[model samples]
Target: MKIDSLTSVQGQQKLFDNGNARVTKVDGQGEQPQPQQIASTIYHKDDPVLPANYGTYDIKAVINENVEDPETMNARYNRVQELFGFGIAERSVDLELGYLSGVESLSQGLRDKDWGFSIQDGELQVIEGSDSLSDEERSQITDALKGAGVEYAAQSVANAVIEMIETERSPNGLSRSIGRFDVNQSNFADVVDLRSFMEDYQVGGKYGKGIVNPNDIQARYFGAGTGIMDQVAAKADETFLYKGR
Candidate 1:
């Protein structure tokens, strides 16, 4: 029962000396003994959290980014022509069109968007206007033209559109330039419509008497790949034959 009295206290202290064991002090004033605090195991407890090794985004960000910049959007527009092209044709678009500047806003309506008109490096806080194509406008224009499935004539149309918007600033000029592109971006192979040619031979009006839109001739006996350039002069009759619909 009396353990302390039975034990050699000094020899016991030598046996249990693993350093700093927790203990409590008891006072005669009927107060409960309070436990002593222990030192933290980790040395750097106040350090900041470590950063992640890879980029991360939420569902909202994913949706927003996809909508703002599609990976690739298939472009298809109905081809309207009075000549042989009175149907549809396959078209291709640029992949980088989505990432072009100002495409998110300007593609909706180029005429409606306002330009931050500055006279000389933010000097003139004048009236708002959409008279010119800055970098933003240029990007928007290129995106639109390229995304419209323009090929071969893309450079010329883009140049003409950019110049018109930059210099002439006329809405009519802009519209006409766009319409002019419709002519240039044609699927019609610079040839007369077979139906129109037949009609002209019978009882025609406009498409007759060499008043053709393209003026190049197309017939059952004739062939495809006939344009301003045959594109493949040697193989025009072989590779690019028009299977008449």
Candidate 2:
């Protein structure tokens, strides 16, 4: 962690002739260190959406869909793929991206600005692209950060942004990936449509349970008709493929 002050020793120096190696304070005798509470929210796709439109929630935008900018879309695609399961698929996608403009660094990858580090949150954080920033460059950034209503650069805002990003990763929700403003849960869920082989095979959902709502696609193989299950699946595949097509 970067700090304002730091000191390191090159060699050992002793001020006292003797030292004591004993426990001075018992556990909980002095002020206790409290765990930092993450003041952010999380939810599942199927869970209730409370605090609806409450505060300035993050709106996730999928590349090619919402984030249509060529450079930015391509630049931020790595985050989408790393956080979300798939990258930009031909299939439709609408997601609420966390940290679209917060907690930025000199990304070795794509940058939002032409040159230098840029964070497009409430305040524009611009770090000049130079090995050693000049006095003018430093003043420019400091003044920019001190602008009115520049809440995005604040630590609280940055924390909230991280919370939302973590939500969309593996432990993400269907609604979260589709929300205008939402967060992902701490788990993962995937699906597959059956127009190919093994149509009758079951795919379990979270916690190894059958999908809460089954028979949702193709009417469970176009109505599992009265016949051997395997035969029904085979016929359904053929029907959906040759007949429907």
Candidate 3:
């Protein structure tokens, strides 16, 4: 849904008061209409349909008054990093799927099912059954990836095939990958490179790696690091997370 559809109090109220009425007899008949009973009955007349409420509400002015200007805060850096974390998580997933499955439209696949990118309760979750790849059985994933092209795609598929071949692989592989990358400086640098590549090549920015066609890389990795930060902010009950001193 369009963000603009969110509720504002700009429109007229849906409820109405039917004017308190005194009964008037039609031709002085029908038992004087019984004083039209003042029992507060509600009725609808022919009026246009009211717009549905979109659940938007104004922030309290008093709260806004006490907050610092976001533009002026050095702490914004920390907040940015936090957001980057979620983005990284999603990116990792996208990269794994793309490099492994040779599917360039993975993000669109998620979006089509309304499972679009989201940070919920300190985690990045793309609901299962929301994407085309996700709808397939394990055997199908193996077959598709094995036939995919690109060196990275081949390697990724090999890894997946191996994992599926194993009996007791870790169930939290994705989560653990995100957590591990967050604490690993080397991984972070790789992410920076990936992000830069995305910006320069994929997104048509000046600083991209330019080694490969930017469009060949999936869009999911471009801003996934930001997704992590969104989860942090949402979970911390803050709009922005300042690097804690």
**Among all candidates shown, the one with the greatest TM-score:** 3
Global Cα RMSD, each model: 39.5, 28.2, 23.8
Score residue 230 of candidate 3 by CA lDDT. 27
- Report the lDDT of model 3 for residue 60: 13
Which of the numbered candidates is closest to the native, going by highest lDDT? 3
Measured with C-alpha atoms, the lDDT of residue 27 in candidate 3 is 37
Over the full model, what C-alpha lDDT does candidate 1 score relative to the true structure? Answer: 0.22
How would you encode candidate 3's per-residue C-alpha lDDT over 1-245 as one tens digit per residue? 21111122122211222223222223322332222222111111121111121111111111121232322222322232222322232334344433334323234433234222212222222223334445453233333333443223323322322222121111222221122223222122212222222222223333223323322333323333333222222332221212221
Each model's C-alpha lDDT? Answer: 0.22, 0.25, 0.26
Better of 1 and 3 by lDDT: 3
Instruction: Report the Cα lDDT for residue 82, model 3.
Output: 28
Query: Could you give me the TM-score of model 2 versus the true structure?
Result: 0.20
Which is the winner by TM-score between candidate 1 and candidate 2? 2
Q: Quickly count the clashes in candidate 2.
A: 4
By summed lDDT, which 10 consecutive residues of candidate 1 come out lowest?
Answer: 73-82
Candidate 3 Cα outliers beyond 4 Å, as residue runs: 1-127, 130-138, 142-223, 231-245
Estimate, for each residue in 21-88, the C-alpha lDDT of model 2 and write its tens digit.
Answer: 11122233334432321112232333322235211123332323231333433333234322221111
Would you list the rank order by lDDT, best first?
A: 3, 2, 1
